[model samples]
Target: MSESNSAGMFSGRKSEGLVLVVDDEPDVRKVVRMTLEKSGYTVLEAEDGEKAIAEMKKDENSLLLSLIITDIRMPNMNGIDVINYYRKEWPSVPLIVLTGFPDMDMATSMLQHGIADYLVKPVEAEKLRSSVSKTLEKREVHGF
Candidate 1:
């Protein structure tokens, strides 16, 4: 890991890029925030996809969203629709989808559509950080 990444992982939250955590479950949101914040990312919470969209829109500098971790199944809107809208509106925001489903075909389709990464439910802290860091690196390379 680079020095910056090491600092992010261990030195505790010096960096301040906003990360949106979208899940219907309160516990998931709480844990995700705790994990990412501990790793140096500022986290924002939204219960469902609709609220997530609203939060993104309410902020003027939506491009600063370092990452969006969204669950696939939600009440008002789903992850797929959220992905579609983000692609249309805020393409700069890197998305990491979380889902309970393990269908390879659906995962393949989501990958093709522009998600930075995907995670299965009950994400480990290391796995989540790894994906977040990987996506951030991709953003740096792609000129986000």
Candidate 2:
């Protein structure tokens, strides 16, 4: 994404909220970051839940996060733990889960745990953008 395009995405907005994207795959993270950055959000990436948690903690003073997008499976720590931690510590921030497994039980569990949306792996660009837009819109409307 061009700097001009990214800047234009939030030029008239009051705030261009930061988004955290977590996944073990570098390719996935790159695509996600590009997608979100093109849409005007500042994106942070972490390779695993531990790194994600550290990123969150490091930004505690800033607290500019508007959303989190994470993959379900990872080494060291999984997305479930990350989601649970954020749900408790930063309940106001919305979360979206991206997983390859797509098990019914896991989906149900994620929803029950306060995820704003769930997406399957190999996500299309349009789908990712749509999901993100809708989720962020909901957060804005509800004053989350």
Q: Judging by TM-score against the true structure, name the best candidate.
A: 1
Q: Considering summed lDDT, which 10 consecutive residues are worst modelled in model 1?
A: 1-10
Compared with the true structure, all predictions reach lDDT values of 0.75, 0.76
lDDT of 1 by residue, 67-122 (tens): 88888786555557768866776677888888887778878889988888878877
lDDT of 1 at 86: 62
TM-score per prediction, in order, is 0.81, 0.79
Off by over 4 Å in 1: 1-13, 59-63, 76-79
lDDT of 2 by residue, 1-144 (tens): 433212123445454567788888988888998887777677777887677767767624226777889887765556577687667767788889988876888888888988988898888988998898899889889986
lDDT for position 41 in model 1: 79
